[model samples]
Target: MGKSYYYVEVESLAGETICLQLPNDLQGAMRAYRQAHPITWENLL
Candidate 1:
């Protein structure tokens, strides 16, 4: 297999703070992360 590079950046102020290091397909990683950790009212704090 060959190595590939991908870059993804979203303005932090747009939503919650994410400190994840996603090296895979950004869309897929984000989808999985959101599915695993859905935001709730308590998260706002």
Candidate 2:
């Protein structure tokens, strides 16, 4: 079985929740998520 690293939950502007399981650490997950959806950053902060 694979190790569980980090779980990231991102909600979109359209009111959809997206879930992702990241193999990297928290920092890496955040970076990847931000890169994938820069617009969501504003809502997160």
What overall lDDT goes with each candidate model? 0.50, 0.66
TM-score for each predicted model, relative to the true structure: 0.34, 0.38
Off by over 4 Å in 2: 23-45
Model 1 over residues 1-45: C-alpha lDDT tens digits?
543333344448778655545556564655555557777522422
Model 1 residue runs over 4 Å out of place are 1-24, 40-45
lDDT of 1 at 41: 23
State how far residue 32 of model 1 sits from its true place (Å).
0.2
Evaluate candidate 1 by giving its C-alpha RMSD to the native, one decimal: 10.0
Clashes of each: 0, 0
Per-residue lDDT, model 1, residue 21, is: 50
Candidate 1 lDDT (Cα, 0 to 1): 0.50
lDDT for each residue of candidate 2 in 1-45, tens digit (9 for 90 to 100): 643355668799999999877555565756666678888853653
